[model samples]
Target: MLSSGVLAGSASVQGPQGEVAQFEYSGSMLRINAAQNDGYALLRDGHFYTVGYNNGQPMVFDAGAMLKGFGDMAPQAIHGDLGAEIASLKDTGENEVVAGIQGDVYEVQFIDDSGAQRSESLVLSTDKRAQELRDALFQMMNFAESMTPGQEKAKAQSQDIRARLSSLNAGILRYGSEVTVTEISGEPVAAQRFELPAQPLDLQGLGKLFGQ
Candidate 1:
């Protein structure tokens, strides 16, 4: 295991969620420091818990505090791009609004001071950046879905595009830090499971577009 307080690699965020923020992992701890007033949580032992938040708000957790389920519950299948989106918003407080367009969606939700929750939805097309990424990912999924069995060429192409998108790091958008893509029963599947950092990040100014 790594020593305590080791400076692991960093990741940034982008899109509507704000900045990339910094992430550090050392020993048995993982830390996420957001650029704006953002926050993050972890799923351990079948429970989801908010380990830290920007702006200094006391953390809270329920018996089952996981994010929306992806496997069967996701609006669409979750993949590397989706992982990037989640990491980007990992620190942007609860969303206060949400919207979707033609299968693309945007949501803004947040927990209030009294613990009440509020959210909104809009046609995802309204946000250029959000719509572009959402559409692209959805298009990839749609293509995969529509592919007939034994269409190896098309499947290969789709995975190529997905990997290409996963490589771009404009700001703090982090994805694929530890990703596994495989073929399961003739279907493509991806998983995001990795250790996290244990300290806050300096989101003010980040270096390099994307690291090696």
Candidate 2:
């Protein structure tokens, strides 16, 4: 259920040292500004680009190449699915409020391609406003997964999760201690928001700096 208009939101991801990464997203792009880092990523016409600052100057690079290089460096073959599929959801009979919206809590069980199981609690809202943000997020995720190599299984898994969530007529407010949605709004984002600010620096040249 992709939204016909742009939607924006603020979110945070919990990390070690109690750190949080700030995120802002529209349907077509996602901007991440974290400690010591600032960047935005987008997929256009099946090409992925990461635009960020280096020495306070804007630069763009091939995100897919960077990810593929990382994949090749792995010592062992990755086994489980990168995106896990939800196996079940059970109401916890609890409720929580986030960003001024109330939601129901549910315990969600997930299984990876390797049959590995894990569980987490999620706060989900059926609020109409949240649904718009959820749809935008789904679009962003799809673009990300499509650009990564060898993500076919993971993509399918992600789609299943989206379908399940939609069937519940809910949007996620919080997922365990990892992520939380702080605010959401339907706004028209400028097209320039996704445009690269400067010409892309060749990945080859960038790698030379690190002697890669």
- lDDT by residue for model 2 (134-194), tens: 7756765655554345546666776776887788878888888766666554454556666
Name the regions of candidate 2 deviating beyond 4 angstroms. Answer: 12-17, 42-46, 68-82, 112-116, 149-151, 187-193, 202-212
The number of clashing residue pairs in each candidate reads 39, 0
Lowest lDDT block of 10, candidate 2: 73-82
| Worst window of 10 by summed lDDT in candidate 1 | 180-189
- TM-scores of all candidate predictions against the true structure: 0.27, 0.73
lDDT value for model 1: 0.30
Number of the predicted model whose TM-score against the real structure is largest: 2
Candidate 1 local lDDT, 111-199, one digit each (tens): 33355655433222223333233332334254323422343433444454344333431111122232111100111111232232343
In model 2, how large is the Cα lDDT of residue 193?
62
**Model 2 residue 23 distance off true place after TM-score fit, in angstroms:** 3.0
lDDT of the structure predicted as candidate 2: 0.64
